[model samples]
Target chain A: GEEVAQTPKHLVRGEGQKAKLYCAPIKGHSYVFWYQQVLKNEFKFLISFQNENVFDETGMPKERFSAKCLPNSPCSLEIQATKLEDSAVYFCASSPPHFVAKNIQYFGAGTRLSVL
Target chain B: SQQGEEDPQALSIQEGENATMNCSYKTSINNLQWYRQNSGRGLVHLILIRSNEREKHSGRLRVTLDTSKKSSSLLITASRAADTASYFCATDISGNTPLVFGKGTRLSVIA
Candidate 1:
């Protein structure tokens, strides 16, 4: 695939319930990143992966948020015990190897999560 | 945390008019890139300017980066109604890290 693909265009979860989102990065892309956007404002980086290894997790909340990228499978982000503050659009992006000259990232349509 | 802040927050212009947006960052960067997002859509890459490059042009879009001031500006020439979207400036600090995005500028091109 030439573009990143995200599953469940919209997801609704009750407070304290678990929510999961999925993303399939572009074919051959080695870097995958997740970001959260609230109120259509600035994007908050959640996590990033280089191939199947975690490249950066500093922006992720360790308590209830977890993510994984395994070979031959789409990456996943799961939130346990969702809160109202967790309501936002989750975007997944993929970029080619960092060694490439440009650092451009291709984004998915995003999953809009609503915590009731 | 966001490192870039966009100016004006929002803007409106008649079709065919040029629109410009500014962004300022708090730290040095390896490159600055612009992205456009239509309502409820994925972001579209606009242009990217390296730290050493001062300006770049692609079709109707022009990007200028001033490393000394840690600021960048995007200009859209002859805007169209379909061009109405939020514009964001993202900075790559080390080229390998995730980009830090700004709040973004909402531009409405009225037909």
Candidate 2:
């Protein structure tokens, strides 16, 4: 695909329920990133992968947030025991190899998560 | 924590006027890129400027970077109502690291 794809345009989950989101990077892109936007404001970087390998996890919350990218499958971000504050838009982005394209990312339409 | 902060949280302009937004970062960056988001949609990449480069232009968009001041500005010339959107500035501290985005500036182009 030419654009990064994200599933579940809107996810409504009860508080404390588990929530999962999926992202498929653009074809031929090696880097995938996840970001969380709250109140349509600042984007908080969550995690990143390079070809199914974890490139950076510094932004992830180790307690209940986990993510994975496996070969032949779309990457996944799962939040366990979701809280009211967890409601926001989750965006997925993909970029070509840094050496080749200088880290310009292409974004998906994003999934709006609502925890009530 | 966010690395960049955009000034003028919101702006209103009549169509056909120019709109300018400013961004200031706290640390050195390898490159700075601007993105626009329309209402509930995802962000669209606008333009990118490298650390060593001072300015760049693409169509109706112009970007300027000053590493010494750790600031950048985006100019939208002859804007239209379709140009109304929230603009963000993201910084790439390292070539391979995730980009750190600013809070964004919301611009409303009234017709």
Candidate 3:
């Protein structure tokens, strides 16, 4: 069994401020992902990384959001300017197989971000 | 685009009753996975069925996949109140694409 650990269970930020979230994947996993859940809606993918390199960032909002996975370190998602719409629970996931979408992913408890 | 759509947005059943949820997808997939979310907690993987497989079972959960119809169903037998949660179906298509999740089915198990 494996786990993805996320820090800062909850966060509160004023509008226009920045918010940063962290995710530590299972030791052997190579693929990491970030998602946003707004209420009961389905999770929306934000970005994915393979080790320290980003694999896909198509779902990211380039003007304000960025994510990186530093060597030997967990991944991080940073939103430079927060907005009312940014209030949601953020999830992190990891998969052991780097290039296979079929690989089952493990998820973290997530960071609940509230933007005022 | 999200590939899966779950039907019967909500369900309420008594204990000992079997609860079933259906899901339909728009595209071909490498595999389909079912997950359960207990309120604000993270999603817990329930079962995964590959495109080549027809039926799979784990504990009290049974999953049936029909590639021809591009649909799947998850059945929970002898459900309990602890099983009350939001269940979602996700699709892993193209081998490398990120999993796209459906809106989910909210099931409430009454004692």
Please say which candidate is ahead in lDDT: 2 or 3: 2
lDDT (Cα, 0-100) at A22 in candidate 2: 97
DockQ of candidate 1 against the true complex:
0.85
Residue range A16-98, candidate 2, lDDT tens digits:
99999999999999999999999999799999999999999999987889999999999999999999999999999999988
TM-score for each predicted model, relative to the true structure: 0.98, 0.98, 0.95
- Please provide, for model 3 over B9-45, each residue's C-alpha lDDT reduced to its tens digit, 9 standing for 90 to 100: 9999999999999999998888899999998899998
Residues B6-37, candidate 2, lDDT per residue (tens digit)? 98899999999999999999999999999999
Instruction: By lDDT, rank the candidates, best first.
Output: 1, 2, 3
* Candidate 2 wrongly placed segments (more than 4 Å): none
Q: What class would a CAPRI assessor give candidate 1's docking?
A: high
Off by over 4 Å in 3: A98-101
| Candidate 1: residue A62 Cα off by (Å) | 1.8
Per-residue lDDT of model 1, residues B15-108, tens digit only: 9999999999999899899999999988889999999999999999999999999999999999999999999999997765899999999999
TM-score of chain A of each: 0.97, 0.98, 0.93
Q: Is candidate 1 or candidate 3 better by TM-score?
A: 1
Q: Pull out the clashing pairs in model 3.
A: none
All models, DockQ values? 0.85, 0.85, 0.68
